[model samples]
Target: MSDIGISTKAMGKSGVTFSPLKVLKGFIPKLDTKAIVKNALISLASILLFVLLWHLGANYLFNIEATAKIEKARTEQGAEAAAQMEACILSGDVSCQPNTLPSPQQVIVAAQNLWADHLSISAKKTAFKAKVATTNADRKAQGLKPIKYTGRPSFIDQILTSIKTVFAGFLLAMFIAIPIGIITGLNENLKTAFNWLIQIFKPVSPVVWLLLVFMIVKTLIRDPELDKSFIIAAISVGLCAMWATLVNTSLGVSSVKTDYMNVAKVLQLSLGKKIFKIIIPSSIPLIFTGLRITVSVAWMVLIAIELLAQSPGLGSFVWEEFQNGANDSNAKIIVAMFVIGIIGFLLDRVMLFVQQSVSFETQ
Candidate 1:
């Protein structure tokens, strides 16, 4: 018999080992990294599949019923259009007509057209700028057509406005929130005073705060010095969303092991040295985490801010898309939606890279 068939007289000192691949699914605990990764990958795939299924279902479900409803609506609208034309011929002024919504296909095409036009215009402007930078005859040489991105409503403009708002607000939030967080974490008295404020503001509804901010900024600030509309919108959004970071940073710093604090004291380190060398390093993980959350919150709140009474960013873009009734507006709407998602994801990844670069490494 082969060695495998023979009874083992003694097990190896290291003991019998089995490959994870040899085990069935669910034969491991939650703490098992191999199993966890495997399961997570599977779950991710499942989620993607579910999302795809949901999209398709949302697009078309129980085909006959959808077709029936669409056909009925189309017929009614066609009849109304004929009546409107008849009335126009008979009467000098024709105002009565059916408020017909565009089909999904029409909306998609419009959205695509908007995206193309936007890219073309953006490219032209870029090329113009480049040529102007290097040569005096750049304008004459650079003969790019003036292709506008949208029709009466400019979705591209709205998106750009939103992006500007997000970046500015996010930066401002970080500036104020981070410093205060550090101060609170470093000093007991400061922490005691600031903790209540953080707690109260953290869960405050973003909409309420934004409305209040809009009122305050618009009423108090002059439009000449600052664009109150956009600036207040951005600031309100940023302020509402950044409390988590402030609180997290303070908590992270406070929770750093007592041993490290003691070591810093023993070394007779200056306050700045203690902060930069000891305290900061210890709380990097938490700070980065908080930053990530804050930025994401800022990004998400952007749409809400824009969609509200006077949203400036992608919110306005989407609003216009919806207002267009899904015909000549769909494609631009889709493109704007994509731009928002891509920008948010990219921004978060950039922050992650920054965190990794600044953070201490452990082998």
Candidate 2:
């Protein structure tokens, strides 16, 4: 009994003591050394090549020659503005060639400046909120309504607006597509009827959808100044992006394994129970694939929809900057392009993670 107790104690100690590093190793994915090195080298080379091309194009091919002529012309004028232009040109300044495609460094600076502006605006918003809270407390005491901020949105605000718009559109697409897909998948006649409509509408442009939705919304909504652009943009994006999901879901449901259907029928399962227990579970993989595509399509279409609708998003910001024609406008647009690309990539990765979590196939 003493020996057994000692062994039990040893086992307990062994169970309680574990290497943290070993525990962490189990959570971390195993790396493929060769693949990792190869990918790293390829990515590095691509970035370096891009930077070299941009620098050469900006300084030698397109910008420097035109800037030199402009500088010389300004120098001959003997004005104070000429001195500033000369200084800017000498430092490889963006102001020297406002319309030229910015160098990578210039784009980086623009991104930094935009980030600074976002931070400044955020600080202002905090102060404004505090002041409003105080005033709102007093207004409430007097039985008056609290006023809201109506200031122009900042860069970050525009980005968040774009994200919100895309999500709204994506949710709307899922709601419309999933039900119709399930119903049509169960009925051949319904599927055949909808096929013609899907084929016709699937190829339609977001701009066309926006115009149609705008007309409908305009007629329904009473106030023109109301925030109806969001509704219009979201509807347009949903209409354009729902097709992939609809097609994939219908196919997935219609192709449910015969064995599964047979088992459900043999068990005398109700239609609702069979659908919920068998149909949806078996078709989840394909459904997730379609959802991933739909989200990607929604994000892509959102920019165009926002721009057309004059909505407060990155798309509108880009358009406004382009029309403003400021010296930093080109750089701001470049920065926005990077932000858009990065956000899209992140959205895809998130969907992929969700797919992997639900599906049997890891890849």
Candidate 3:
């Protein structure tokens, strides 16, 4: 009787002891917050150190002999001229060594100036639009057609143009590559036939592709003002960037499980059903991976293509600024470079997110 009573008491104590502890454990986070904070601080420190190093290196005294004349002029011309010269050197206004490698502060100031210039241009555009509207109303009343603004493209406009060109090329590559890849993957004979062509074209440079595209486009297109450069650039980008997608998609398709094929055969599915339900769904991950690489290649190739094609994009903007060699030219180029890198990173991250969303396996 005593043993039975002890067992009952022990069972009664077990419910209250473990249940609340398990409930409280569920509220705890799996992540190590301290480690995350530590990593963030380390990244911040490294960036700060890099900026500090850049500041030191850019401002270091180089070609002191060349700048001696300016220093002498500063000493003799009194405080006003000396201050002006100093400001000019710091801002890369004077044509010298300092002008070539602009300091971080100078780049920042140049960014500000570029923003201001953009704002100024925007204001002018707004005014021009207002004038155009007034003139168009009058012209419409007189049964005449409206005239659009024909001013130079702004920085933002060039950026948008680049984006459009890249997307156009990327879409073209996808359409060409995915269909061909699927076929090649499904058929060994077709893969063998196309393998040589893929090998030959994959190593060709973007500049070479641009030249080839130009030759073809020039023969076919007679109009320059109707956006011919854009077409050529897009075609060139497509040609250069399509190989990755083609290869990956083929591999992905070929690597599909034999069991899947057996099942499809057992089910006696039609060709379309087999491709859509079995092959394409399984190959999406690799195809997307290829697409990410293709997009990156397209973006990288676009700058060179635009430079060669003289298209009104960031590539042209960089080339124009380099040729112009103004005080702020280097900084503007740097700005464009950073913008390109940032955009590429964002594109990769977006593709990664899509891959994760659709992919079967995740870690």
Residue-by-residue lDDT tens digits, candidate 2, 1-363: 677566557756889664556556755898889999999999999999989988888767445666666667677875666777766667867556546687788799989999899888888888898989989999999999787777878899999999999999999999999889988888999999999999999999889999999899999998865789998888888989999889888988999999999999999999999999989888888888999999999999898888879999999999999999887888899999989999999999999999889996556
Give the lDDT ranking, best first: 2, 3, 1
Over the stretch 1-363, how does candidate 3's per-residue lDDT look in tens digits? 677566557756886454545544655667888999999999999989988987777666333533664676678997687666666666644564344566688788877887788888888888898988988999999999777777887787788899999999999999999999999999999999999999999999999999999899999999755788999999999999999999999999999989889999999999999999999998999999999899999999999999989988999999999999886898888888888899888888887888788888666
**lDDT (0 to 1) per candidate:** 0.70, 0.87, 0.86
TM-score, candidate number 2 = 0.85
lDDT, model 3, position 11: 56
Candidate 2 backbone collisions, by pair: none
Give per-model TM-scores: 0.65, 0.85, 0.83
- Writing each residue's lDDT as its tens digit, candidate 1 over 1-363 gives 355323232233346554344343334444878888999999999978865675565455424433554456558777665555555434533242222333344445666777677687777767766655545454346774433233333457666787788888888888888888889998999999987888777888878878889778777886574566687778877797678678878887778888998998899899899898988789888888888888888888888777774655688767866786543454456556667898889889988887777677671
In lDDT terms, how accurate is model 2? 0.87
Q: Global CA lDDT of candidate 1, please?
A: 0.70
Clashing residue pairs in candidate 3 are none
